[model samples]
Target: MHGYTTDKDDYLKRLRRIEGQVRGIARMVDEDVYCIDVLTQIAAVTKALQAVSIGLVEDHLGHCVVDAARRDPDEGQAKVKEAADAIARLVRS
Candidate 1:
């Protein structure tokens, strides 16, 4: 049904792994782990989240935006704008 349809499970698995990583970071804090070590884990989690965001953005452009464009040029343009706005927000974050 969509670009990510086949890989939905994979996304979920990755997200779950990231969740575990977050929990681990919490544990590290609880144990008073070294600041650098905690920062390393934090960086890893940030990158993992960025990866997921990029994947979703790709799926949006490849599937939802394309489908909308096919249905109507104006609608497609709107989708493109929306996607751009989303990317901008993500970049700002």
Candidate 2:
């Protein structure tokens, strides 16, 4: 979080764009847009989300994990595992 503090505004802007994309998807569904076109937008949204997830993961590793490692070995190990699990979940999604 600390590492991301400086880039928080940028992140928020990106997320807002993604939110708009989701709304666009909903509108497309309501309008009965072509199936393939809808799927293409979905893929775009997915990639956008993954990009955000990767950024957050990087922030966590750089800030939280580093802090935890500095504070204590056990905490550091826990933080690393948590980060790994986060990546796993993102990959699965």
Candidate 3:
């Protein structure tokens, strides 16, 4: 099972909330709402996504990476590298 399996439902709920926020932003644009207000909502959505990403990363490291290390060092190293790459992408985003 994936590392975040236990928290999968929570993640889904958070993602759904973020999705709604995005739709709201689109609605604001369609309504020609104030630009700054729209931008503020966009920022909020971005932060919310980042928060989810961080939680997933923590779960991965705590569960997946640790389990791999217990099973095999090489597998653990691979997982670590994969996780590092993922984090790099997140940071770049």
The better-scoring model by lDDT among 2 and 3 is 3
Question: Superposing every Cα of model 2 onto the true structure, what RMSD results?
Answer: 1.1
**lDDT of model 3 at residue 68?**
97
RMSD of each: 1.1, 1.1, 0.6
Model 1, backbone clash pairs (residues 3+ apart or across chains), number? 0
Superposed model 1: Cα runs more than 4 Å off: 1-3
Deviation (Å) of 86 in candidate 2: 1.1
> Per-residue lDDT tens digits of candidate 1, residues 1-93?
876887899999999999999999999999999999999999999999999999999998999999999999999999999999999999998
Worst lDDT window (10 residues) for model 3?
1-10
Clashing pairs in 1: none
Better of 1 and 3 by lDDT: 3
Across 1-93, the per-residue lDDT of candidate 3 in tens digits comes to: 888999999999999999999999999999999999999999999999999999999999999999999999999999999999999999999
Q: TM-score for each prediction?
A: 0.94, 0.93, 0.97
Worst 10 residues of 1 by lDDT: 1-10
How would you encode candidate 2's per-residue C-alpha lDDT over 1-93 as one tens digit per residue? 376897899999999999999999999999999999999999999999999889988988889999999999999999999889989999998
**Candidate 3 global TM-score:** 0.97
lDDT for 35 (candidate 2): 94
The lDDT, on a scale of 0 to 1, for candidate 2 is: 0.93
